[model samples]
Target chain A: MRDFRHDHSALALNTATLGHNVEGAGAGWSPERVIDACAERGIGGIVFWRRELAGRAAAIGDHARRSGVEVIGLCRTPFLVGPLAERDATAIADDFRRAIDLAAEVGAPVLTIVTGGVAAGTKGMGESLKIVAERVAQAVPWAREAGVKLALEPLHPVYGGNRSCLVTTREALDLCDGIDDEALGVAIDIYHVWWDGDLSRQISRAGRRILGFHLCDWLAETTDVLLDRGMMGDGVADIRAIRAAVEAAGYQSFCEVEIFSANTWWKRDPADVLDVMVERFRTVC
Target chain B: MRDFRHDHSALALNTATLGHNVEGAGAGWSPERVIDACAERGIGGIVFWRRELAGRAAAIGDHARRSGVEVIGLCRTPFLVGPLAERDATAIADDFRRAIDLAAEVGAPVLTIVTGGVAAGTKGMGESLKIVAERVAQAVPWAREAGVKLALEPLHPVYGGNRSCLVTTREALDLCDGIDDEALGVAIDIYHVWWDGDLSRQISRAGRRILGFHLCDWLAETTDVLLDRGMMGDGVADIRAIRAAVEAAGYQSFCEVEIFSANTWWKRDPADVLDVMVERFRTVC
Candidate 1:
């Protein structure tokens, strides 16, 4: 395993971890401030959410690059095909194309895909997954044109019903197989997949198709499924082992810290949260 | 699939659905009352928790049988191994034996095993699962002697850390394969596995080794991961499809209704809860 105790450059900040996803949640740090703070800490990269980027993708991308930080990726496109997705299929396709364009404009190598939860009136995940595959297939041309990859992030099963039907790395890979687009891959997040018994095998199968890797902890007693993610060392996940597996599978990218602790870390100073993330990245993760 | 609408004879009430698991949660209906209520409604069977038995397993079992209601199964044995398991291995083994004796005394054919959460100081689920398999292997002799089958229930992956390390039906079957004992099998619960993409395949693989089948719904916007389980039909799970798969796999056992709805069902009258369960079991499941 690569040693992280003395090196901090591989650490990346997923903007949502600083409370960018939820309205009125964290320290409300601006994208510029977040970038400067990460750069000040010797952090190597930042993944921005669409909501935070507003119309500033190009400027933010340039700012991060100037600050010696890579634009790791984007948070997500709106649900491709689920309850939250645009009702019209064309709207969904247009929204996805715009996201790919944004990824290209921002110089983000990957655009994370959190395929929305069960489609309205759908009885099970099978139908919704099929819809997701169809939509991703349609968007492949745009993604390839933009020179950006679409990283399907399978949320935890807890989010299967209403958040994202894509709930496992294997399922994500299966979707990738059907699409068969070089621009499509997976973003493996420990919080959503640490419990998976076949995680190691799936990671190995993913290999170079692993576009991004996320870091966070699963609290022993998670009070809230969506917002109560623990900081790396504060929970029971075997971070080092999972990272070793990812690295062994040829993933040599930023280890993005993507916590959503509403009550704890999010309540602290943004600088403090960044400092702690860097510390844990070196010591725990 | 069997028509639940006209015939609830295949329906089994798991006591926890009435708030038996949490203290001061459900209407304080006694076991005798629960049995009589099920029989009156033409409900087929009832599954009791160990706590409710309170040394009266024999009498309750006899009464239920006399009332034409089967004692389908037992709620659980204390976790065989994990963070919540007893530190002394012998104690875990002894507790399991006692649980088996209770299941036999109650005339229940199967004892549900919720193999516990992550083991203390364990970094990953692999080590904890091995411990669970070893412990279950040790208790197989006692289970066989008591004429009771141990049904390993794999909880949702959300509970992998503090509730159960066994988080997939596939993983549960793997444990059964390791033990290779006729006394061991799996309990397939919809709430724990509706999101599994390989659900149908795993059910087919389980075949006759499926000792029990549990029913419940997964609410689209789940508020609580542990206690906010939905009643059948109230959530988005394809209960009938899953039931079809289980029945196709040669599982002729009762469809056990086991919801842990702290905010909704538990607050209702016990009779009202039972009535709703029957209504939904017929219409939704």
Candidate 2:
């Protein structure tokens, strides 16, 4: 595994870490400011949420590239299943294609897919997953055409109800294999998959299909399920070991710092947050 | 698949549903009172938390038997791993044996094991699980001698850090196979496993080694990770389908209702809670 002890050449900032994703959360840092901050800190890449890219995808992507920071990925597309999923079939398909388009316009190499909650009126995940498989299959042609890879992010089981139905790396990979599309892959988020005892085997199975690797910690006593995430070194996750597994599985990309620490990090200065993120990336993660 | 609508002869109450497990939570009901309530309602079994069994294990067991309700299970053994686990090796082993003795004295058919949080100085579950395997192997003699079955209950991954290191049914079965003891088996709780896509396959693999089948629902908008469990028919779990899988696996035992609803069910009258449990078992579940 590559050593991250001295430099942050492999580090990236997910905009959520700065509170750009949630409303009334962050310091309202503009995309330009976030990009400049990354460049100033020697961060190699940046990821943006859809909320920040309203109609300026191309401009933001170009700005990041001009600043020598690659826009490695986009935050995510709208959820495709569950209660939060678009109600109409056509709307779901259209919204997905639009997300692919956004990824392309933003020049993001990958577009993350958070398979939303179980579909309305569904009991367990079977029918919802089937629906997710079908929709992703439908969007494959557009993703293939746009040259934007779709990385399915399987969330923690806690989010199985209202957020995303995909809850394990194995399930995500299985969905990817069923689709058999070059454009469809998986984003391994430590917060979601850290507790998975079978993680090492699944990472080995993921190999080249592991398109993205996210970093965060699982607090021992997590107060909130949705927002209370920990900074990398502050919690119990075996960050170095998981990263070793990811790197061993051929994921030689940015180790994106994607924390949703609403009460703690979000309340701090963005500069402080970035500085600590860089330090933690080098020493801890 | 038995017709639960006709009667609750297969139903059991895991006393946590009555808030007896946590301190200062329950209605201050005595073991005799709870046992009598179950017998009066035709509930065939009762599972008691270790808290309520302080020094009255044998007496409570005798009282339940006299009331024609089998003492089906004991709530849990002390966490054998993680932070809450006893620090001294000899102490953990002694405590485990003591729990087994308590199970024998209580005459409960099985003692559920909620493997506690990750061990000190350990990073993921690897080392902690190894410790769990070794300790459980060491205790097989006592468990077998006492004729007290130990049922490993894999909690939700959310509880992986503080409550349990064991987080998947597959992982639990794998541990059981490693021990390879007839006295060891798994207890399936629906609250922790309703999101798993591979559940049906794991249940098929569990077969007769499945010693217990727990009932509950996963609320759609669950606010708490430890508490806030939903009652049957009140949440979104496919309770009947999971029970079908468990039953098909030759687990002809009590469908134990084990809920930990902090704000909702515990605040209601115990009689009302019992009535709702019966109505839900007859209709939705």
Candidate 3:
């Protein structure tokens, strides 16, 4: 495994972590500025949600090429299983295609896929998984052609119904297996999978198929599922242990930092956030 | 399984659910009164925590007996793998023994165990689980002799560090398997295990060994881990689906209601809390 102890040249910052930082003051900064900030700090890469890069797609790509900042992976794009109008499905698919195009332009290695949550006003887990499976099968070929492997990210179960139906590493791998796509795998995030009973087994199963690695700590008493993410060493997650397990499973990849703390890290200065992240990355992660 | 549509006589109030109602100005009712209230309502049983009964232990048994309140199970007792001084370990053991004795007095069928989180300053997952296993093994005999089956409730990963090291149903069951005691099993609380991706498989494995069933909805936007639990139908949990799965696995037991919402539910009247609980239980669980 690549040593993270030396430098953060392999570290990728998910822009959402700093979307609300002081650097991104008015209506939050653009993706171009997000890349610039990472470059300023000698950070190596950026993993961002393509949807967030809407009007500035070309700008982001151009800046990354000029600045030598490797865009690690696009945060996500996926089909949420539900009864939507045909027009809406077409629009979503087009959006995903555009995201794939953007990732290729920026030299990103992968496009994260988080199969959307249960359909509206529904509670059936089996039905949701089936819907997700069908949608993912349809998208695999397109992703492969774009040269961007789809990184399926299973969210935590607290988000089982509303956020993402794909909620396990094994489940994501199951999708990969069903679709039979070399272009599809999983983005293993410790914050989401650390609590899983089958974590060690699943990490080993993921092996070379772990397309991405996201890091963030889960607070002992989590206040909000969407926003209360703690800094690396602030919470109780045994991150290093999980990282070791992931490494042992043959995932030699960037340790992407993805924190969504609207109340804590979001309000801090972006420079401070990056500084502390680097310090913790060296000592804790 | 058992029909809950008719009445909650087959259901048990876990007290923590009633915690929200038992707080505030006119809500300083003791745990003894909580039992009386359950009995008055013809509630089938109560699964209580020793802390709730600590102050009233002197008279709790007599009160429960007179009121015909069945103590279904004692909620918890476990010193997670913390580095307790010799005195601390003794005190913890003594406290649990007392809890088991009180549970025996009240005819509680089980004493729930909650091992402490990882020892202060320690960081690995293996060491964490090892500590919980050692602590739980030591308490098995006392719990067995007290006629109280020790039910280990694996808390969610959110509490992996400070509250309990056992963070999955499988982990708890593995501990039970290690102890190999008829007196040891697991307390399956939906709040904690509902988010588990392998929930169905684990619940199936738990089968007849599931000593208790605790229910509460997981709000899509949970604000606190210690509290902020929603009423059965007020949140996103597939309560009926989980209940169906558990029942199918041969757990013919009371569906204990256990919400800990200090903000919303706790501020309401006890009567209102009970009324909403009854309605939700009928429709949701």
Candidate 4:
């Protein structure tokens, strides 16, 4: 395992921790400002949401690289299976390829995909997953052509109903294998998978297919399913242990910190949040 | 599978849907009133929370039986492995045995247990589950002697951290096999497990060890994790499909309707809720 104590070159900020606290009327921080702030703190990388990119993907990528921070990856593509996703396969494929194009333009090595909820007119996960797999398979060649990896992020099961049907690391890996492309892999998020009893075994199964590693704590008394994510060390998650398992699985890459704390951390100053993330990275995670 | 469209004699009500509306100032319904209401609806069985019994277990059982309503189960024991649960093995055993004795006194053949959250100081579920297994094993003999089966109710993963470390049906079955006792089994609640991709296979694996089957729906836009559960046909869960799997697995028993809807059903008249439950069970489930 690589030491993150004093050397945080492996650290990455996922911009979402700031949430509405960034770039809104009350808060004025452009993409360049966020990148510069991260670099000033010795943060090695930054991942941006598509909404913030706003068609300036290449410019933002260049600015981050020049600022001594890598654009680790893009936040996500549109939902591939839910009501928010495209209605037909052709439209879905077109939407996915567009996201892949953005990832390529941004010079991001990976494109994260939060698969949407249960498919319409479907009974259970079997058909929904089939639709996801088929749609993902269709997008693979374009992803490879752009030199970007498709990272399927299996979200927490709570989100399985409307956000993403993909809800397990093992399930994500199976989808990757079905596609049979080197461009396909998984992004392991601690928040989504920490409670899984067979996490270590599944992490072992992930091995080199891991495209990204995400950090966040699962607050034991999580009030809101979508927004009550805890910052590191503030919750009951076994952070160091899960990190060890991820490291042992050979995923010693950009460890991005992504917390969607609407009621708590998002209300704090961005600088303070980053400082605490770094401190917790050294001691707790 | 057993032609539930016209006949709901297998239906059971787990009184939590009534929440505080069942008893309190302004609510005059007693335990006997609830039992009589269920029997009047042709509901074959009913499960009661421990607080409502009030040391009159035998009396309540007799009252329900005379009204032709079976006392299917007690809602739960105190959390088996949480902060609220007894910390020491002896204390935990004493508490579990007492609950088992109560189940016997109420003539309930099964006791549903909502295993509490991760063990107090434990880091992931490994140590917590071990503690749960040990504590449960210690009480199994007592449970067997009382003719009550200890049904480990693996709650939704949403409740894993602080409500129940036992999350997945597969994991619960593994624990049951490890304890290796006839009295040890699982209660499959649709609200907790409908999102599982491997539900059917796990249901098949459960086979004869399915001590109970609880009904409710997973509303797609679920606002509250514990409350806000839907009626059978109102949510995204494939109720008929899941029932097919459970029935195929040999769980042709009293299917309990256990909805903890603080925002919806709990606010309505208990009679109306039971009427809707019977209607949904006949049409959807």
Candidate 5:
């Protein structure tokens, strides 16, 4: 297990934790301001959401690098196949390609993919998953050429209906297997998978295919499944244990903190939230 | 597969669907009243919660039988293991025994078990699951003598922290395997297992060990993960497909409708709720 206590360089801020895209929530920190704040705290990296990028991916990427911080990853391509997805297949393909291009422009090594939930008119997950795989396969060559990895993030089962039908690490690994592309892998978020009994085995199964590791806590009495994510040490998730598993599986990279707290943390100052994340990252996670 | 439209005898009402135990919620319909109403509608069976039984298990069981309605099952035993469990193992064993006695007294063949979530002072699910299995093993003899099957109900992964550590049908079946007792089985609830990619395989694995089949829908935009469960056809779940899987696995039993809707159904009249359940049970499920 790596000691996160003394070394804060491995800590990465997932901008969503600072309330990026949520409507009317968050501190509303600009990209440049967020970069400077992270750099000031010796934070190692930053994961930016597309909405926050605002056509400034190249400039933001350069600014972070200049400030001695790395652009760790990007937060999500749009829904590839759900109710919110673009109905036309070509549009979906084009949208994903643009996301890949954006990641390359920002120099982000990984682009997180939240494949949307049950497709329109589809009754089950089977068909939606197949569509996700077919779309990913179509986008793999472009991703590889861009020198970026596509990280499929299997959300918690609660999001299976409309957010991301990909709900298990094993399912993500299976998708990776079928695609058989080095450009594709999985992003393991403790909030999504800590409840799984097979988590340890599946983490081991992911091995080198594990592209990104996300950090957050699962409150025992979560009021809202989507936006009530707890900060590390505030909830019941075994963060150190999961980190141990991920590291053992050869995942040596930034530990991204991606919390979506609509009620609590989002209401706090971004600076205070970042400071708490740093402390929690050291002592708890 | 069985035509629920013309024949509602296969339709069973889990009183929770009519808003029975939620705090300050649901129309507080008495057990007798619920039984009489189910009987009038030609509803096949009714599953009661322990709280609603009010020490009238024997009388209520007799009442349901006389009314030509089966007491299909009991709602749940107190959590066997986890932070919510009584620390003293013997107390857990005793409580479980009492619950088994109640199930037997009520003439219910199965007692649903929601093994509690993360254990006190424990970090991961492994230890908690072991504790659950050990406690269940200790109570098996009592259940067997009472002729009450202990049906482990795997809650949704969202509840894995404090509600139930047993969050998958496969895990429940695995627990049953370790106990190796015919008296121990699984209650397959569509809401909990629908998100699982391996649900079909796990359902088949359960086969004869499936003691009950619970019906409910997973709403697309779920507002409350615990309390906002949709009535049969109102949500996007492929209820018929799940029923087909359960029936294919040799579970020839009532399709129990167990929903926990705090905002919608619970606010309606119990009779109206029953009417909608029958209509949707026929058309949707």
Candidate 6:
């Protein structure tokens, strides 16, 4: 078990958290700037995002090594269901291969994956799940050979149809078992699973299979499904209790802050955002 | 099995769909106006909201009967657990009693009950479920004695923490069985259960225990958990298919249109709302 309380050295900036509060040119700060900023902050770990990894891989890897920042995990290879599955298979495979190479180069341990949602042109959600499971099983060998763990992240049921096929921790574990390899595991995001009826049991079941842990609060009145994430200590989730449960489950990974807030946080100052994240990480998270 | 293809006579208008659109309003449209609108349109059934019944139950009942409108179902009795449970018990019982009286007066057959979210002041979600089960069990005898069936409506998992203790069809049916009363059953709302992986099997399991069927589409990109509901054909949900599934489960009831659209439907002319609803009820729902 790792002691994260000692310093920000154990903390991983998901980049999305910084992106949540700071807009640069496109949406928020560019991925390159996000990486540079984290490096400057003496942040311990950086979880690179797939969409932002293409042009800045070498720069990020070199900077992280020079500055002693560990790239802990990659943001994602989206789940293997829906339109993205068949229509963009080759493209997905290429991106994933690149993601694996980048992770290996940057010393990131895992590539976080959200199993894709129902096929855009279909009416069956269960059918989508089956397709996703099958595709994941097929993708396991490449991941294992690359020496990068494939961390399946189960999103909330609210996103059941359009975002991700996997909606429960137990279900993610079940899929991991089907993959039947060391490379396949889970990225446990508290925002997505805090309300689960089987949460405590599932967290315990996750054990060492929890490859990563993401933190964010679920507000009492959520306005947007994708962007209205609350910061830690801002919502109803018992963060300390959840963290204790995760620790008890044998997961000693970096606590990655991932908040997607279009309205509230995005308008704040970047320095203010990092300061608050550090403060919250120390006390609340 | 009532054919709504030719007219809106088989459709019941859940008053919340129209009346409770704008939050924090002193009062929008009167219950009498809602009743008159439904009656003039020859709508077969009008689902009465409890909020409307609080002060003017007799007047609404008389108006409905005089206008030859059938009250198909009572809107709700909200229940959760712990402090809310104790606080809501008297209020719920009083509300249920009043709802039953209103139903009797207007010839309504069922009263919808929403088992609330995890207890606020005490107990976890699981414990809250137990409290809700016990509370509903205690309320069942009164419901049976009053000859008004109590229909438990399971909300979506998004409302897992703060809105409803029950969030699945199987869970609601289990609660019904736990209560052990013929008067207790479930109201199957497509908006809440369409994304459920076990939806078809659970709806089949519901059988004749399905007391009512409510229709609303879940938008692909929902902005709000409570009010961003889509009109029948505009969203991702297969409303007609779910309706068919419920009907196959032996739910011989009016197909109720219940939407809470803050941005779209509320801003439209009320008549336009009904016009679209009736057209969709004919072609889509």
Clashes per candidate, residues 3 or more apart or on different chains: 0, 4, 6, 0, 0, 5
What is candidate 1's lDDT per residue for A1-285, written digit by digit as tens? 778899989899998888876666656678888899999999999999887788988999999999999998987887977666789988888888898999998999899998998888878899999999988888888889899999999999999888899999999999998888799999999999999988899999999999999999999888889789999988888988899999999988899999988888778778889889888888888
The DockQ for candidate 5, computed on C-alphas, is 0.75
Q: TM-score, chain B only, every model?
A: 0.98, 0.97, 0.91, 0.96, 0.97, 0.90
> Clashing residue pairs, candidate 3?
B17-B259, B20-B266, B48-B75, B79-B116, B80-B115, B80-B116
Docking class of 2: medium
The parts of candidate 3 lying over 4 Å away from their true place are A20-37, A78-88, A221-223, B20-26, B30-33, B82-87
Find the 10 residues in a row with the least total lDDT in model 2 chain A: A20-29
Least accurate 10 contiguous residues by lDDT in model 5 chain A: A21-30
> Candidate 1 on B62-181: residue-level lDDT in tens?
999999999989978888666677889888888888899999999999999999998888777989999898888888998999899999999999998888999999999999999998
Interface RMSD of structure candidate 2 (Å): 0.9
Question: Candidate 6's residue-wise lDDT over A155-267, tens digit each?
Answer: 98788766786788878888777767888888888788876666778889878888998888877566677888888877756676777888899877688888888777766
- Model 2: runs farther than 4 Å from truth? A22-24, B22-25
Model 4 DockQ class: medium
**Deviation (Å) of B244 in candidate 4:** 2.0
TM-score of each: 0.97, 0.97, 0.90, 0.96, 0.96, 0.82
Minimal lDDT window, size 10, model 6 chain A: A18-27
List, residue by residue over B154-225, the lDDT tens digit for candidate 4: 888888778998999999999999999999999999988988877899999999999999898887778888
Every candidate's CA RMSD: 1.5, 1.5, 3.2, 1.9, 1.8, 4.3
- Tens-digit per-residue lDDT, A1-285, candidate 3: 556777888788987787543444324777777778788877888887766677676677778768868888986674555332123667777767776778877678798877766665656456678877877777778878988888889888666656677788888888788887788888989778876767778889888888888988877656677788888888767788788888998887688999988878888777788888888887788
TM-score of chain B of 6: 0.90
Residues A59-135, candidate 2: write the lDDT tens digits: 99999999989999997878887878778889888888888899899999899999888777779888888989998
Q: Which candidate is the best by DockQ?
A: 1
lDDT of 5 by residue, A1-285 (tens): 888889989999999998887766555668989999999999999999887787889999999999999998987788999887888999989989999999999989999999998987777798899999999999999999999999999999999889999999999999999999999999999999988878889999999999899999998878888789999987878888899999999999899999999889998888999999999999998
DockQ per candidate, 2 decimals: 0.84, 0.78, 0.36, 0.69, 0.75, 0.33
Q: What residue pairs clash in candidate 6, if any at all? A: A24-A28, A79-A115, A79-A116, B79-B116, B116-B165
lDDT of 6 by residue, B66-98 (tens): 987878888777554533444746776666576
Query: Between candidates 1 and 6, which one is better according to lDDT?
Result: 1
- Candidate 5 clashes between residue pairs 3 or more apart in a chain or in different chains: none
